[model samples]
Target: MFNKKHYKFNLNSTFAKLLGSYLIIISLILTTSSLVFFRKYEKLIVTQEYNLSEKLLNQANYYVDFNIQWATSFLYSLYLDEDIYDLMFSQSSHYKKNGISKLKHLNLSSSNIDSIFIYNKFDDKFYSSLGSPAENYYLPSMKNIIYKSKNTFTDAFIPSQIKINLKNNNITKNIISIAILTSKSSEKSLSSAVILNLNANTFSNYFKHNITNNSNLFVMDNNGT
Candidate 1:
């Protein structure tokens, strides 16, 4: 006769208990490891994103500061240019032509410079590298430029001088202006200023080129513009 053996599983046996405990410990270890790994990965991703954003911001700030410094230095040089002084104080058209030509050349050579305006208080005349003089209607803003003791940066604004306009009359290109007040003599008040307009797209394009499409960026001064 063939013997048939049947075994029943005993839940309370020492061997069963030991096997259950081993399985429970292994499950716990796996769950804990998974949690720790996940947490570490999440933290690492956050840190990397923070570093990238910080680097981008620093690069943008440096670019803007460098341009401003360059503009400031250019203005300082203009203050020493005899042509500019003659254009402001003298009645000679020759000096005026030379100054205008110089401005035109400079404006043409620079990619970022949008427009250049030289306001002479003596003749109440404005000369521009863009050809036509700034309309006298904007005289208040011009005077404000000459009155400032320090170099001033303006909020993004539609230039009254640049006639280049979009199809919609109201839609005009925004420009940021850097103006410097200058005086030929120490005894005299500032009688002239050079207003240099920079295309707002320059900064925007810079950010676009350096940053990913998914990112959003803003450039603002203390006044929040």
Candidate 2:
């Protein structure tokens, strides 16, 4: 009978060093993959957020610009109407009365328009859309403004936060008032003005009511007031 042979395991430098290096390399690869994925995901999220913001801004601007163009064109047409010319120069109260009557029936009643006034420099008179003469007291405050913007359109009244009576109600509100010098080649050059008073609340509410959030949308004037 032969004795059984015994076997023993050995720990060598070459094998141990190679195993340690392999583990370190595998750990490094995993860390690099995680870092790359995190960076790309963060960039994607940022890009999406930027695109959304741009789209919203463009939409807001489109609505604002459209309203402005519509208002401007309407005012121009009112000033150029054939009957308004007679009202500007006529000394006869009857002609002025007839003109006022015609203006009331013009169907200029839009959601944004509160009232309209035609001021004649020659007669120093004003006709209202209400089929009456505007009070003389309100004339002095706005006379110089109409003259300064001769043959052009400008802000007739600046918008403010001050409380005032509107439609028989005392409240704080903003109003958009514009004045345009009417053509008067037959009498005096640019001797008349057509003023349009806009209901700013109606215009601004159009934007706010469409949104679910209680966000305020401000329509700023050229003066930023």
Candidate 3:
């Protein structure tokens, strides 16, 4: 015969076991909910950062383009100046001296302009903001060394010594040099170069001001090279 009495349920002990199981289930549910909330918060932060980075990059591009356009306009004005042409064509030493000084003064006044160089194809001479015969002159043989790409802005090139003042304890300064080749409708060719010594600290400060969280901001060129 089956032992029905021994198998009978104990009400208090059974209730205690049921209650323990319910508590464990509740703990697991709470843990899962917390984990889900944390993950959602993390994803939101990442998305915000990405959006901010994109906005900054777009602003930087605009700034760079504006700078380039400003430089090109200045160069065109210089090229069209009758005085500049008279100096170059006449081969007059006096005119060259005065013209160089004028160019230097003009260059110094422009914001972000480190130096400016004008290469006279007529005399094969170079004039720069540094005053006399440009120390960093590019010879005729070195012309067109860089590739011409209308779609890309070339990488930044730093000249070892753009200006050296022997009188000032032989101080040498590095400059960020950029060049553009120009051709007139009349088949006349002229090369104009601009050097800008970027103030890194000032630039970084400007970026910080424009960007809310600059930690995620990064800059890269078109080539991704």
Candidate 4:
């Protein structure tokens, strides 16, 4: 038979061992709970970011459509102008100046429009607010685009470079462009293209809400360049 003192010592040792095991189990439970809570928080954050990104993409698409519609309307009105038709058919310098003057007046009336110009492919004349007359200002790529599309509105065509200068701040940059085709004649007798410059910053700022500490976002078209 074991001594009574020895028996008491064994009981005390066993109690200490049980207490240690309980402490370990409690620690494991706390750690598991903390991990689960963190995972849920991370998931919530991811969902919010995704929603924000989708909203931004929608906003961008909306602006693109809005600008295209505006351009279409502008071109439609221009096509209705008798002066433009007369200028195109006559190929006379006087009529051309008159048409350009009317366009300048229209540009001045609208706040959103920075400038407006007409390019006559038949006569190879360019009339614009810039006052730089060129015998041939038409880009072949643009010409091909206008030729292939017979619709009233065209898709967005962004340029590769955009440089912006802000006072007391660093320079910023972005890319945005659009083109619209005006049907001067239903019988394919006459047509003119309208090129529009959109505010890239305005378009890009829609995605600002989607930005997170470690996330990235971007947009691309079919060209994938």
The candidate scoring highest on TM-score is: 1
What lDDT does candidate 2 reach at residue 56?
60
CA shift of 134, model 1, Å: 8.6
Pitting candidate 2 against candidate 4, the one with the higher lDDT is 2
TM-score of each: 0.78, 0.63, 0.65, 0.62
lDDT of 3 at 20: 82
Better of 3 and 4 by lDDT: 4
Say which candidate scores most in lDDT.
1
Model 3, TM vs. native: 0.65
Give me candidate 4's TM-score against the actual structure: 0.62
What CA RMSD would candidate 4 show?
7.0
Candidate 1, superposed: residue stretches over 4 Å from native = 1-3, 133-171, 183-190, 220-225
Best-first order by TM-score: 1, 3, 2, 4
- lDDT, candidate 3, 108-198, per-residue tens: 7755665565556567566666654344443331233222323122344333343345555554444444544333212244433322333
User: What lDDT would each prediction earn against the true structure?
Assistant: 0.69, 0.65, 0.55, 0.57
Clashes of each: 0, 0, 0, 0
**Model 1's lDDT to the true fold?**
0.69
Model 1 agreement with the true structure over 1-225: per-residue lDDT tens digits: 999999999999999999999999999999999999999999999999999989988888899888877877776676568887776677778778899899889887778877677877677677777673333334455555556434333323323333433344543455666665554323345556677767777777888999976856777756676
Q: Against the hidden true structure, what lDDT does model 4 obtain?
A: 0.57
